[model samples]
Target: MLTPREFYVVIERDEDGYYVGEVPQLKGCYSQGDTIDELLTNIKEVIELCLEEQEESNKNLSEFVGIQKVSI
Candidate 1:
């Protein structure tokens, strides 16, 4: 069996009120949905597709450190 891997998803609500999700570890890996739950489900599928399309040997996923808020 293959080992399970975890990924960090960055989610944001767009101006149109859709929830958008993106995986920083995988370039161009993203998805959207009407609700948070739906977004999560959709993003999971997208992640799977991205993983399958990438060559395992060449896959270089970045570690998720943390997100910070900046003050102007």
Candidate 2:
């Protein structure tokens, strides 16, 4: 069995008030929900789908680095 992988998600609330979540490690992986709980659930499903698709291509998942905030 494969070990569980932990992914870092960047979340934001759009102008419409929906919570949008994106996985930086997985390219083109994102999902939105009405609430945080829903968003997380949806993101999990999306990640699974992305992984299956990646299996064929054998793409490498990027390592997660810490996020930083900068002000000009």
Candidate 3:
């Protein structure tokens, strides 16, 4: 059996009130849904599709340090 890989997901509520989820590690991996649960489900499917299209050369994902806010 293949070991499950863990990925970090970032979710936010957009201006239209939809929940948007993104996998920062996977470029262009994003999805949206009306609720958190739905967003999670949608993102999972998107991640799977992205993984399927991922090439061996693109498997080296960058390390996620952290997110910060800056005020002027």
Report the number of the highest-TM-score candidate. 2
User: Once superposed on the true structure, which residue ranges of model 2 sit more than 4 Å away at CA?
Assistant: none
Q: For model 2, which pairs clash?
A: none
Estimated TM-score per prediction?
Answer: 0.87, 0.94, 0.85
For lDDT, candidate 2 versus 3, the one ahead is 2
* Candidate 1: C-alpha lDDT: 0.91
- Residues 1-72 of candidate 1 have per-residue lDDT tens digits of 999989998999999999999998888999999999999999999999888878765777777788899999
Q: Which stretches of candidate 3 lie over 4 Å from their true place?
A: 56-58
Q: What is the C-alpha lDDT of each candidate?
A: 0.91, 0.96, 0.87
Candidate 2 accuracy as TM-score: 0.94
Q: RMSD, model 2, all Cα superposed?
A: 0.9
Clashing residue pairs in candidate 3 are: none
lDDT of 2 by residue, 18-62 (tens): 999999999999999999999999999999999998998999898
Evaluate residue 64 in candidate 2 and report its C-alpha lDDT on the 0 to 100 scale: 76
- Rank candidates, TM-score, best first: 2, 1, 3
Which of candidates 2 and 3 reaches a greater TM-score? 2
Q: What is the lDDT of residue 6 in candidate 2?
A: 93
